[model samples]
Target: MIQPIFVYGQHILEQPCTDIQLESPQLQNLVNNLWDTMRNAQGCGLSAPQIGLPYNVFVIDSQNAFQAIGKGFRKRYFDAEDKGIQGIFINPQLLEVSSKMWKAEEGCLSLPSLIKGVSRPWQIKISYYNEQLEYRIQEFSGLTARMILHELDHTNGILLINHMGLLIKKYLYFKLKSIKKGRVKVSYPISTR
Candidate 1:
């Protein structure tokens, strides 16, 4: 079943998530629900904290239509396949990052309407354990890199709002109020404050 994705400014996104035990069924459920919620919301990735789960699990699907554009060269190099709507990561750890940085508009599933221009590394190499507890290392670039970094931030209790300046934060604060009143189609998650 799809779970409710917690809105932005929730305390959960600021607290580090616990690492998952490879053999735990609770970890499996977290992976499942993250994927379900990501797909249901048409998101390219989701983290456990976004759904109020405090586990280091996240779902990524790079094959979505939006990712196809501006990613042709990257696709050829990564050989990304249609992984059937979900790639689950458990206890993911960032190993290294390239010096290249890319600026892009970033949004959070937890913060629906909050889109901001943020700069992130263009590529990263990450090591993580899969469902069967086997360790794997993969290189991600471009949009995939951005998605990975965003989800990983959730595991570490970071949010895109943290990157926003004071003016932007104030803007979102008032916008969040309108969302709470149902006056707008919420673009970011409803603030818990």
Candidate 2:
């Protein structure tokens, strides 16, 4: 089922999530719901908390994002090898990140109509359990890394807006306020309460 995404100002978006029980009967359903919800919203990634669930889980399918933007945009920002990744991440751990940093524009479904240029590591090493509950550690670079880091922040109760400078936050005050007050319009379903 495609769940409604919790918008900004919802306490669930800020509450840190707990590790998912691998043996739980609902694990697979939760994973499917996340993927469905993300795809329905046309998002590259989605975390459990974004849907009002408190589990350390997120789904990513950057291939959709790349295809949506077309080849030229992909060629400009990504390497030939960066085809993008598609998978579920459960109880993920950030093992390491490269010193190299890149700043790029990012948007979130929860914060509709808000986009910001955020700086994040170009490469990341992460360990996560896949949909089958198989544990694996892997390294990711470029756009994939950025997407993972963004979703990882969600599991940690950190929003992309948290990365903005004070001045930028001040500049976006009214817009943010409107979003928090459930006044923003978005293509997908969002729950402000």
Best by TM-score: 2
lDDT of all the models against the reference? 0.75, 0.90
List of clashing residue pairs for candidate 2: none
lDDT of 2 by residue, 1-193 (tens): 9998998899989888999899988899999999999989888999999999999999998776666677878875566887887989999999999999999999999888888888999889999998778999999888888999999999999998898899998999999899888888777888888
Against the true structure, candidate 2 reaches a TM-score of 0.95
The residue pairs in collision within model 1 are 111-188, 111-189, 112-187, 112-188, 112-189, 113-187, 113-188, 114-188
In model 1, where do residues sit more than 4 Å from their true spots?
66-86, 178-193
TM-scores of the models, in the order given: 0.83, 0.95
Q: Residue 136 in model 1: shift from native, Å?
A: 0.8
Residue-level lDDT tens digits of model 1 in 39-90: 7777888888888879888988766744455555555323355222346788
Each candidate: RMSD to true structure? 3.7, 1.3
lDDT of 1: 0.75
